[model samples]
Target: MGLRKRAAATVVTLIAAFLLPLAAQAPAQAAATAWTPGISPLHDGEWVMRDIPGGDQADSWLKNCARASGIACVSVGQGDGKQSIFHLYKCGTRSLSNFIDALSVLNNQTGGAEVRFTGPNVGTYRAPANPNVIWKFPNAATYDFNTMSVC
Candidate 1:
């Protein structure tokens, strides 16, 4: 009889022991799984600039502005202090594809400011905040801006 009681007690104890860990862990597990906010870098209204070659005399100044501001000078129409367009690094190394995506995004967000990859460098653009729009050909051919131009 005593042996039977001991066996039953052992089984119950084992079950209780296993369940205790799970029961204790439930609240802790829930807390750990919950997400805590504010882990990412906040860049609201903040931007960086970069200069890509191809723009005429103005290119140098834009490059300087980007360098001075401790950002990047990725391409043209970026560094001019007059426009104050907010630019940023590609979060990492820049690739041609990434630049294309960036250009598309910038052009889309900034109200479709004529996003011209400069004809001068088919790889560059004369992008700005607004008011100025010019597409330059590799031969320095420029498509003058009128009212119907893009950003």
Candidate 2:
């Protein structure tokens, strides 16, 4: 009986010891990031390029815009710092794939062509025509742009 009681007590102690630290870390883990709903970074008619690279290889299609002087490209920055470079054609709107944590956009369009980003609430925001310019969103998941219109 004594040994059983001791074994039960030891098991309880071990369980408590393991769970205490996790409990302590639970709040921190549950804490929301800057991109979370605690604060919204996007506003109506706000330019997503107001602020500011690459791991995974998720290259999107670069079809149809070949008529332009230079190839226009766009890259989406993922939350884990991985990026997907998309070759965009001009004269039409392209829908983006479902990407996780789109933190930034790189407008690598040439010939001084601006890439227009359209969202539901944010309206239309045009990226700079300058090639190789990177635009970072204010938060990690701020701008949820639906389509890109390269001109």
Cα lDDT tens digits, model 1, 25-50, are 98887655422111012145334433
Q: Model 2: runs farther than 4 Å from truth?
A: 1-69, 97-103, 137-142
- Residue 33, model 1: lDDT of 42
lDDT of each: 0.34, 0.48
TM per candidate comes to 0.26, 0.46
- Per-residue lDDT of model 2, residues 97-137, tens digit only: 44335534445556667767666766766766654345554
User: Which window of 10 residues has the lowest lDDT sum in candidate 2?
Assistant: 33-42
TM-score winner? 2
Window of ten residues with lowest summed lDDT in model 1: 96-105
For each candidate, how many residue pairs have backbone atoms clashing (under 3 Å)? 21, 4
Please state the error at residue 12 of candidate 1 in Å.
0.8
